[model samples]
Target: MTGERYPTTAEVVTGARELTLRYPDLCHLGVVGRSRAGRPLLMLTVGNGSRNVLVVAGPHANEAAVGGATVLRLAALIAATRQRGEDDGSAWHFLLCIDPDGAVLNEPWLHGPYTLRSHYEHFFRPCAAEQPEWLPHSGEAEAAALPETRALVGVLDWLRPVLQCSLHGIDVGGSFVQLTSEVPGVPERISKSAAELDIPLERGSSDAFQWPSPGPGVYVMPPPDDEVAVGDGAHSTWAHARRYGVTAIVEVPMWACDRAADTSPHPDPEQALRIAGAALRRDLPLVAEVLRAIAPQLGGGDCALLRTVRELVALGPRLTADWDPAVRALDAAPLPPMTNARVTSIEVYAQRVPLRAAAMLRRIADVPLVARLVDEWCAAYERAYSPRWIPVADQVEQQARSVIAVYEEMHV
Candidate 1:
């Protein structure tokens, strides 16, 4: 648990397997699925009873920190549970590495001497299409279907966990966690945990603008407008959980846990695991608390919002002029300067607002008053610009950037 800097993926997996074997009474480990290249999608279950908490890491290969950390944390948790003999009837299960292929793609950098710019250029920046995790399958292609996706889907369906966490991380800046707005009280608990660990809360994910004075450590990302469910995609594990009545949390570890100051070198595998373990230990209790509070409304809500999001993406280029004024206003307002990153963030927001407004209308199915309010908001935007005023391509690009900002705000 406390030696060396970074551990290789093979080393981490081997260690995890050993832990499961060493503590069979407290843990159940197995291959729930396979990656595209046929590597086992390893899973570990700790504790006993029907009430389960699910954690997933390595959804994207580049973000292997989450998987490594989760494995180590599971080992520690199992040890603690055995010593205490606390049969609380609550179990924690994890899909330790959901995308081994993707993770393997990032193995060269896992050991250390992390270079942010180099890593971004060599690995992370390409769109989902270029990434194994995001590629869609076709009937005729030989390498069409990804083993990782199939394996994950099967396990998720079988387990149907009460609460799920999909682990991910960013290259630059502070640590942040992502959760659905539907999960009430999560933001505060997460913020509290981050403060305890001295990790600054990021107001949003990578796409969001950095605040003028980003407070010392990690911060919570801002929430999207109440009506719109803006996020990566409906295809994500988090979105899948929403469909199946589970509360999901996406943990984004920007850097090692112990190295709070931005000065330290990226942790080696050993150090990274230690950092990850500490974070899960510190934050798990808060996750449990949030789940308890929102149990009643877990999977009961209007799903139409997802459809509206898709429509907005399709209509974005056409909605350019309508959103330009708002974007300009946001830029002019007392906020951070519009860096290339920030510009992208603003565009994402501009694209999402209209979609959210539409979704709000559908949400208030029976409440005429609320529906009327949403309609009025939508109409006002509709009247704000002429169809031909802004080029469709430019509008679409701007909206895309705005969506990124909204995500940053939510993560921070």
Candidate 2:
């Protein structure tokens, strides 16, 4: 078994190379690209077969856990498979570190004592344009069009992987996983695996969480509209892979580990790594199973829900005018390029409009279906705005009660 310790990116590379040298027939190393500081973006191939699986990490600088865990796990997997004297000979190729520039910027504070607030302020506050991961350059037309992206794009084009998982972490919130393409039976398997690991199953993006009862793998939410653009350009792995006939594209949240007891600081980094590593080792097989089940129905659904969401956002300014003038002011202001005005409006409504909606729901429309839809939508909004699901639900319910009390007082 690999040592239960946190390995730096350099150490991971050295260790991977050493493992490959020891098991020449089973392992090989390839340079995909270089970071801004000229660190090699390495790709490691385990097993001799042709089934390529690509895992990318550290697309965003602050989300280092994804990349860190991925490299360490890849190294460990290679070593273990070789020692077992079992060359399964599956062609499993991993683009282990896709964003070395972002990873490096985050490495300095890996073992530091900075609070989440300070960490965000120091390392994550940069606008996407300023970020090396998102900023576009001469050859690329998106933010963070670094050399690392080019190498990744090249590999995806060459390999045409069957599965692509991009690992990311949220600073605060319950754990969740996202799949671009929904597969049959996959949701249940993911939920079961996450439950075993003690992580909740979520759906959609983090912005909207009106997930139905059988959630995917964590909370079901929608991605903010602005974040969508980050996935559109050439620098985006999802966009590039889809073009290359790649089937499964998922973003796995780091916090959603079976063993991640809490997002709070762990007294033992080794234990944390072990828990996370074990979770991945166990979950990947489940993920592979889901991929096989969903392969037939690829690209089947009409993304009408997403389109409806866009329409609702476009109508937000008009809706907010009667209740809050600040909405108009914000809409009229010269906002930054990447800011999503709609999301801001929804956030404001989460803080202010629930009471009015609750009263209106109770009074104007007592129809069960409409009321239920309204309640579910409101709950979803609350879940998105607040990190803790229970408290956010409680506060929203209290506001609803207050609205009812006010209506009764006015009547009296």
**Top TM-score prediction, candidate number:** 1
Instruction: Give me the overall lDDT of model 2.
Output: 0.43
**TM-score of candidate 2 relative to the true fold:** 0.53
After superposing candidate 1 on the true structure, give the runs of residues whose Cα lies further than 4 Å from its correct spot.
Answer: 1-4, 117-145, 206-231, 255-412
Q: Ten-residue segment with the worst summed lDDT in candidate 2? A: 390-399
Best by lDDT: 1
Q: State the lDDT at 225 in candidate 1.
A: 32
Once model 1 is optimally superposed onto the true structure by TM-score, how far is the C-alpha of residue 214 displaced, in angstroms? 19
Across residues 85-166, which tens digit of lDDT does each residue of candidate 1 receive?
Answer: 8665656677767766656645565455443322322242112433333434334453554666556666667777655655
Task: Please provide, for model 2 over 95-214, each residue's C-alpha lDDT reduced to its tens digit, 9 standing for 90 to 100.
Answer: 556655555545554544433322322343222342333435347564346576567767777887655555554433333444433334445554454444444333323233232223
Task: Give the whole-model CA lDDT for all candidates, comma-separated.
Answer: 0.44, 0.43
How does each model score on TM-score? 0.54, 0.53
Off by over 4 Å in 2: 1-6, 78-89, 112-118, 129-145, 207-214, 218-235, 245-412
